[model samples]
Target: MINMSILKSLGLSINPKLHVTVLTGAGISIESGVPIFRGKGSMWEIPEARRLAMRASPPWNNKETWEFYEWRRKLVSQCKPNAAHYTLVEMENYFENFCLITQNVDGLHIKAGSKRVLELHGNMWKGRCMKCGKIIDLPETPLKTLPPCCECGYPLRPHVVQFGEPIDNKILIEALKASKEAELFLVIGTSGVVSPASQMPILALENGAKVIEINPNPTVLTPYMSLSIRGKAAETLPKLWKSFFTD
Candidate 1:
């Protein structure tokens, strides 16, 4: 059981009627065996990996891009949702209003049975046609073609928000709306440095919402959090959920 003294010092309360919003990042997926593409020791930090990823974005380099996404899809397919994912799903059921905003492209939260998730980064399993703009589920791995085409014969690319690309306006609007209205906000496993998305916790604070931060290390938003719990999400979230909801 969590120490009540700690909760008192942190100014956190458990109320089922509260409107809650949770923002998650790569840290939550790390326990599920997903590799973060950015940050220290990330694959993208490697020179060759960065080169390939950047090259994969253009039509001229579509084959290389498709190969990379296919590899990622296979890895994601093998991963299972972790304890943290299940805890969030339980939070959704307990709260009167709940919105889960995630920066991960992995669909683990959805796979874990979270119904109100907003994927700030697009899903890796989906593909979008470059010409016709039709989105579809990518075919099975070891694809028959290097870069498959849409039914309209246009090139298909991974349906993700790539670096230098803007997030979908519709998704961003919804995220902002949720943040502005939440009564309790949770920041889990994010660096709290990435733009726009990183500003969410602050928005919640400005709107008079209480903020809880769960991360293994201190980040830019640490000082602003009403409660800062330093631990892995997979290790901490289940305990948090039980402490607050199960009495």
Candidate 2:
């Protein structure tokens, strides 16, 4: 059960009228069997694989790059959205203005039916044309070509923002705006390391939002949160979601 004491100790007053913004990270999907990039079984743990995931090395159209993304597509396709993802969807319905900002490219939040999601890392289920700059939704089934081309006959790249690349300016600006406007900011399951994304909760704090962190352990962001609830988000989030009701 969620510690009801959190209400008193943290001095948090939950109401339906507040604007809630949630930020999630790879830790939320670990239960769904998504391989985190820094973990032991990660697809990017391989030396050559790391090169393909970063903008510092091979070009997006390289054979190795395409092979890596193909394998990644298969792996991600097999995973499903977890309870935490579903809770976010429910939370969205509970509040009038809710926005989900995620560092994961897995598309689990979208899979769980979250309508107002902003993926800071782009998405694995989409591909961008290298030449034509067109964005297309990629299917889970194997593509006929290794370097899938656009209708314009140009090679496609994974839509994710790779290391050494900037987050899309438009998306970043919107996320920041959401953070600043949030009455309550929920920081869930993130390690508090990744850039720009890591900066979001701070912006929330600066703008007078009550930041609540739900993670199994303390992170760089833990101390700043108005309350830090120690637990897995899959378990903790559902309880928090239920508490929004008066019943």
Each prediction's TM-score against the native?
0.89, 0.90
Q: Which runs in model 1 stand beyond 4 Å of their true positions?
A: 5-16, 45-51, 59-61
Best by TM-score: 2
For 31-100, candidate 1 gives per-residue lDDT tens digits of 8999788767787766765676666756432899987787677768889999999999988898878999
lDDT of each: 0.84, 0.83
lDDT of 2 by residue, 27-130 (tens): 89887888777856776766766665563234666556667776677778899998999999988887888999999998999999999899998998888887
TM-score for candidate 2: 0.90
